[model samples]
Target: MGISKISEFDCIIFCVYAVEYRTVSGVAGPLVILEKVKGPKYQEIVNIRLGDGSTRRGQVLEVDGEKAVVQVFEGTSGIDNKYTTVQFTGEVLKTPVSIDMLGRIFNGSGKPIDNGPPILPEAYLDISGSSINPSERTYPEEMIQTGISTIDVMNSIARGQKIPLFSAAGLPHNEIAAQICRQAGLVKRLEKTTNLLEGGEEDNFAIVFAAMGVNMETAQFFKRDFEENGSMERVTLFLNLANDPTIERIITPRIALTTAEYLAYECGKHVLVILTDMSSYADALREVSAAREEVPGRRGYPGYMYTDLATIYERAGRIEGRKGSITQIPILTMPNDDITHPTPDLTGYITEGQIYIDRQLQNRQIYPPINVLPSLSRLMKSAIGEGMTRRDHADVSNQLYANYAIGKDVQAMKAVVGEEALSSEDLLYLEFLDKFERKFVAQGAYDTRNIFQSLDLAWTLLRIFPRELLHRIPAKTLDQFYSREAASH
Candidate 1:
C-alpha cells in the first residue's frame, strides 16, 4: 500500500471520464490521480481539494483506475493537482438556493461574492433554472418608460418584456445600458444615505446586470458607475470577462438569470435582467458545437439556436400569482450591422420587441443615437396617459413617429434627385427632419427632459407643418395641443 501510494503520486497517465468516455491525457486539474480503470461509467466517485482548503463532491467522468477522470463541480483553474490531494467523496454536485439569496451576486458556479459570510445551505435550484409555461402567462400590460423620448414615445418598453437593443460595433450600447440602470430606479436620497429607497421603490425594483466576456476596464466601469450612482445597493452584478474559459460564457447568462429568478420570484422584487453582448455567448456555443462535431445551422449556428434563445427569453415574465416580475433587456451587437444576422434575426423573432440603434445617428454625434422610426416597443401605450403622465403624450408620440418616418423617406428620395428637384413641402420636411434629429434625438449632458418636455417639443416641431396636413393626429389632440406658433398663426 505504501509503495502504491508513492508511485501513484509520482506517475503520469492518460484518463477517460466515465459518463462521456472523455479523455484526459495531459489534463491537469484540482483532482489528484486516483484509481485508473479500462473504460468509463464507473459508479465509484472521486474527490478533489477545493480552493477554500475544504473538500467538495465530484464524479469519476473517466476511470483508467489509478488515473481516472473526475468531473469537477467547481472548475479547476488554479488548482494544483500536485499538492492539492484528491479524496473521492463519492458524490456528484449540488448547491443551496432558497428564500435567503434575495440580493446577492454569485459567480457562474453559484458561489457568492458580496464580501459577506457564506450563506446557510438550503434547497438548491439548478443554476439553469426551469421556465414557466406559456399557457400560464398573463398578458403584459405595464409599460416601462425609459424616460428617453426616442424610447418612451416611439418604442414603448413594457414591463415583463424581453426587449433587445441591436447596435453595430463602436456604438454606445454600453453607455445606454449604464444610463438605464442609473435612471431606472428612483433617485438616491442624499440625506437618507442608509435608506435603500431614497428615490426608487425599495421593495419592488432591483437590477440584475450580467456582463459576459467584457474587459476588466469595462467591468470596473460598470461596477464603479452603479456604485457611484447608488444603483449598486439594489443592483446585483455578475461579471464574466474575456479571460474566463469558453464554457463559462455559456453558464454566465444562466447564472445571471438564476440570480434574477431568485430575487424576482422568491423575494418579490421587480427585476430587470440586462444581458449585454449576447454575441459572445453565441460564439461560445458555436465553439462547443464545433468541438462536439454537431451539424451546424445557418451561418454556422446550432440547429437549436432559436430554442436555445427561447429558453432564456421565456424566463422573463409575471407568473399568475407572484407580485415580482422579471423583465429582460438583452443587448446584441450585430455583425457588420447586419440585421439579418442569425443573432439579431432569431432574437427579434423570440423577444416582444427590439430597440434598433442607428449608426448614421452616431455618425452625426448623437448620444444614445436612437433612430426612433425603426425602433418600436410593443408595449408602450399601456403605461402613458393624461393620468399616467400627460394626455398629449400618446398623440405627440404618434405625430413624431409619423413625421420622422416621412422625413426619413423624403431625405432618401432627395438623395436620388438632387435637393433642387424636391418640392417645397418636401424641403420643409427635410428641414424638420434635420432639426428633429439634432434637437430631440441628439441629447447632450445635463439635457434630460421629462416625458412632458419631450411631448411639448414634438408638438412645437409639428406646428411648423400645415395643421391641415395633420391627418395622422386626432382632431381632439390638435384642438387641445397648444403650440406658440399655432397661436401666432
Candidate 2:
C-alpha cells in the first residue's frame, strides 16, 4: 500500500514519544524506524515513516553529506531500518487544532491521547498561530474570584486576564491549580477542599491545561484531581513528560495555546489556560539552544529567553470583537527557590500579576499557601463590583493591607525596642497582626465564604487595631465597618 526506501545517518537524536498508533484495518501497525537522508540543509531534522504507516518527525544530530543524521520524534519501538522511508517536509513542525479538540486530551505534538476517536482531518487548524495584534486588544478587567480569601483579598485574579503561580518545589501549586480550574466560573460557591459544583453553570468556563516535562505519576495525579473534582468534562489537557525528548516540552505550550485560541476566538468561548512548571520548559529551551550551538545568556539560558516566554505568555487576554477571551495561569518552580531565576523573572514582566505560594505559609498548613503582600493583580479594580462582590471590597482590601503592613512594622520595632517598653494599647495592637494572618490568611480550601462574609471577617480582625492604623481606608469607611464587639472580647 506504500512505497519504501533505505537510508543511513551519522547519529540519531530522539524526540518525544507522543503516542502509539494502530489502525482499525491494520493498515498501519505499531510503527518505529531509524531512517535518515543525505544532505546538509536537511542535516538538522529528518522524517522517518514507520512500519505502521505513521510518519515520525524529528531533528538530525550528527551528519556527513553522504549520510546525514536523524533524530526520531517518536520513540523507536517496533520497526527496523531497512524498510523505513525518510523524507523532508522543509519546515519546522506544526500541530493541528479545531473546536473538536475541546473534550479531547492531546500530547505535546497535538496527537490524541485518549485514543477514543479520531479527529476529523478537515477540521484541523495550524497550531502555530501568529501573534495577536496589539491594537485589537482590550483591557482584561473582569475579576476571577477563587473564593480563597487570600487570593480574592490580596492578589485578586481578574477574569479575562493572565496571572501565574510562583511557588517552590513540594508546595501545593498543583492543588491550587486544580482548585481554580474546578471553581472558575461554574461553582456558585467554593471552599478549600469542597465545591458546590451542582450550583455552578456547566458552561461557565472552559479549561485548557498543559503539563510540560511531567512524569506518569504527576500526570495521573492531575487526571484524578480533575476527574474527582468534576472538572474533567469541560477541560482539555496536554501532557509532555520528562521521558519525552526535550523538544516536546518546547512545543507543548504552543499547542495548548493554539487550541485555546480556536475555542476562545472562533467558538466564542472564554478559555482559561493553565501551565504548570514552566521551569521545565525553560530547561528544555536551554538544552535545545546548546545543541544548536547558540550563545547563552543568564545561567546558560537562551538570551532570547525573555522574548521566548513573552511569545507564549502574551497570548493571554481579551481581544476586541472577539466575544471570548484567553486567560492564563502558568505555574513555575524556581530552581534553588530563587525568585530571580530567569523563568520567573521574565514571566513576572510579561504577566499582569503573580500569586506567590510561600514556604512559611505552607509550614503553617495553609491550603493555598499564598503570600499576601508580594502577590498582586495589576488589573484587579476593574473586575470587582460593589454588589457582585462586596460594596466594600475595594476599601476593605486596601485597608486590611495597609493595617497589616503597619502591624508588621509595629511588631518588628517592638521586637527590637522591647514589648514591655510599649504601651498596653500598642501591645494589643501588635496582637492584631498575628490574628489577621491566623484568621484571614489561613483557611481551608473547602471553607466557603461569600464576599460579605469575608469582608465582615476582615472587619472583625480590624476591631483589634486602632482605626488610625488603617491609612488606606478613609475615616468614613472605618465608621461603616467598625464592630462594637471590641471591648467585650
Candidate with the greatest TM-score versus the true structure? 2
Q: Write the per-residue lDDT of candidate 1 for residues 307-403, one digit (tens) a residue.
A: 9888888888878787777889999999999999999999999998789889988987988798876677776676555444556667778778788
Model 1 misplacement above 4 A: 1-106, 110-123, 185-203, 386-389, 445-447, 485-489
When summed lDDT is taken over every stretch of 10 residues in candidate 2, the lowest stretch is: 23-32
TM-score of 1: 0.78
Q: What would the TM-score be for candidate 2 when compared with the true structure?
A: 0.80
Q: Which stretches of candidate 2 lie over 4 Å from their true place?
A: 1-46, 50-54, 59-72, 75-85, 90-94, 98-100, 186-202, 448-450, 483-489
Computed on alpha carbons, the lDDT of every model, listed in order, comes to 0.70, 0.72
Candidate 2 per-residue lDDT, tens place, 1-489, comes to 886554585466789443222211111112222223334353234566667787667654444444444444565454465455565554545566666776677787778888768676434554557777889888876556565777776667665788889998889888788777776662222223322232224464788999998889888888888878777878988988778766678778988988888888878887889998799999987876775566999999999999889889888888899887888999999888899989999999999889888998799776667877888888888766453354467888887777677777788889888987888767766787778878888776656554445666788887776776666777765666675753122
Return the top candidate by lDDT.
2
TM-scores for all candidates? Answer: 0.78, 0.80
